[model samples]
Target: MSLVVPAAALGLVAGAGTRWLLVRLPRGAPVPVGWCEAGLAACWAAVALAVQAGRLDPRWAALLAALSWLAVAGSATDLLVRRLPNALTVPALGLVLVALVPAGSGAVQRGLAGAVLLGGAYLVVHLVSPHAMGGGDVKLAAPVGAAAAGAGWALLPVVAVGAAVASAAVALVAVVAGRAGWGSRLPHGPVLLGVALAVVAVAVPGPRIPG
Candidate 1:
């Protein structure tokens, strides 16, 4: 088989396996909403590989992929535990930075800047309106920032546009289903994941998740 296709498939397996491992954590989240975790890893990994091969800028693709997983892993954590834990977010923060070395210097900058922006925003939100956000979410910023910052300034728009669009879509879906009300509580993590992936698609359009 061709290298890209098989690698893509492996990504899917890895994503799903990550989910299974997530289940073993203390969180109470149930089965995933969909194959999102799998999609996130497998899909982005393929892109990362392609970019590394010079099909795209290795740095940008890695940044996109890392951010994409932050959204994915965070969302999944919240879904399972209703809270994002340092157990996951902390290591993930380190992981994101480590993942950038090969992407290039631009990626390294993006990783740093994005992490700062995301963490700072989470902190402000937590201190002022803790209900609107979680401390764990703040911890998630390191990785998110690392990934986005590494990708380039263009990713900033991807994140912003993706977040807005995904939020509206989810709200629209809830309203159509009649489950969410004017003040109903929703899982922001999943919304964030959706937005991140959307940004990736915009940045690096390609096949569906690996499997």
Candidate 2:
């Protein structure tokens, strides 16, 4: 109960750091400093609630927080530069491995396998049509896959479907608003990371404690 405020404060600090990184990174667009700060603050608050409700394993908290940070960082970079840097994505996979260690051998195995599978699938797609998917997204997929599978493999599909649907919807809106034309590419990293975060929220839900 008491941790939520402090967690949110920590998240704001992390978000400020993220905003600083975004400003320093090569970018074609202005960074949304306020949005990033708010997003992480909200994510941390949610994490605290999940923890308080006993829905999330304390052992997995660090992984959850790290994933949240990665999502924000990757999305901002991809949207601003249309590139996902190895700077953000590669270290995320390593962090996933480090974060999942305390969850035991089975979890570590599942996380690694999930990483390979998702990363491989994206790599194949990137090879087939470089225009359709970016290298950054392929790299980003590994950590997201590992995190989802570490929680439970069933979420892999949820992440897939959610991302696809969200992407399509965003594209539709862009077209309708005349901001983009048909077949134009939108930054996909945001949709992927956003859906992954949504899945994490769903996976962590527990019965509400009656006040």
Candidate 3:
């Protein structure tokens, strides 16, 4: 509870750093700094709140926070260039794995399993239809899936279904509005990361009031 505000403030600083980092990247550029900061702050605050509410274990906080930041980076990159750079996604796979060290053996195993599950699935899709899914998305999934599963195994299914449904809904809306045809491809990284972060950070059941 007491840590939530500080967490958000830290997020602002980190978000600004993220913006700078993005601008420096070869393919990353032109993200609005304010929006980035606000988004990261909200994500930080949500994770803090979840921790205070006991929905998230303190042991897993670092991993989840890292994943949140990665989500921001991946989303911005995907939205800007419609590509996920190996510079970001590949390194993230190792970083998140390292972040899971303190969580012990069970978490390490679960996280690895999650990575294989999600990343492999994306890879299969990419192999089947390169136009449908990109290699960057597949790489991004490994770390995101690792962190989500390390935090909560249930989040794996939640993120998959949520991202799929949300992407489908957005595509439908775009088609209906004549902005895109049924064949139009939307960037899947943002949708997947956003849902994964939300589910990992705040999807646990809230405290029940007197009924």
Q: Which candidate is the best by TM-score?
A: 2
Residue 179 deviation, candidate 3, in Å? Answer: 2.0
Candidate 3 residue-wise lDDT, 1-211, digit = tens: 3879999999999989988877788765667768679878987887888778777766667777788888887888788878788887888878887877767777778788999999998899999999888888899889988877876688788887898899899889989999989889888999999888778666433333110
Query: How many residue pairs collide in each prediction?
Result: 8, 0, 0
List the global CA lDDT of all models: 0.64, 0.79, 0.80
Q: Where is the poorest 10-residue window by lDDT in model 3?
A: 202-211
Most accurate candidate by lDDT:
3
Error of 3 at 29 (Å): 2.9
By summed lDDT, the worst window of 10 consecutive residues in model 1 runs over 202-211
Candidate 2 local lDDT, 20-66, one digit each (tens): 77667554334676766887888888788778878876766776787
Off by over 4 Å in 1: 28-55, 59-61, 172-176, 204-211
* Model 2 spans with C-alpha error above 4 angstroms: 25-32, 206-211
The positional error of residue 170 in candidate 3, measured at the CA in angstroms, is: 1.5
